[model samples]
Target: MIGALLIILFSTKDVWAPDNINGLILLYNGDIETGSIVRVEEYNLLAYAIQTTLTQTVLEI
Candidate 1:
């Protein structure tokens, strides 16, 4: 959905700085205090977010 599209659009290497695009994906969906922080590349973050989104959509069906 929108989140996936945003991830793909922002993931373009030539258009965006990887350092500036760094972010955290809440592993538990909420309750951030319990989640662990792991360093990852920008592309990896985008891929992981897209994958998680798609998986959730599929599971919802």
Candidate 2:
């Protein structure tokens, strides 16, 4: 019974791992980025996501 329980626990964790594909940059939380998500680097302890936006200024000079 113990062996079966262990297997079930491990399998459940693996299923959760692949589901969450998004990650946040801890230091730069306020900064907005533009472009599509290219990749994610788990080995480097980093999460990468991209977004797209136009560069413009609201204030008239």
Candidate 3:
């Protein structure tokens, strides 16, 4: 019973990994992006792209 529970617990990590949606970003150019928001500055917003594994900054929006 304990071993089965452990297996189930570990498997859930993989299943929930992709479901992590930090937030949404709406750009002024009419493009939408979903990722983990890094920072919000005066003139720009920075976020870590989930699909690309990189940081993106939007100056207009």
Clashing pairs in 1: none
Write down the TM-score of every candidate.
0.22, 0.24, 0.24
In the range 32-58, model 2's lDDT, one tens digit per residue, is 354323333554333333442232212
**Once all C-alphas are superposed, what RMSD does model 1 give against the true structure?**
14.4
lDDT of each: 0.37, 0.41, 0.49
Each prediction's total of clashing residue pairs, residues at least 3 apart in sequence or on different chains, is 0, 4, 0
Model 1 local distance difference test score: 0.37
lDDT of 2 at 54: 34
Which pairs clash in model 3? none
Model 2: how far residue 56 lies from native, Å:
39
Clashes of 3: 0
Would you list the rank order by lDDT, best first? 3, 2, 1
State the TM-score for model 1.
Answer: 0.22
Task: State the local distance difference test value for candidate 3.
Answer: 0.49
Q: Which of candidates 1 and 2 reaches a greater lDDT?
A: 2
Residue-level lDDT for 16 in candidate 3: 55
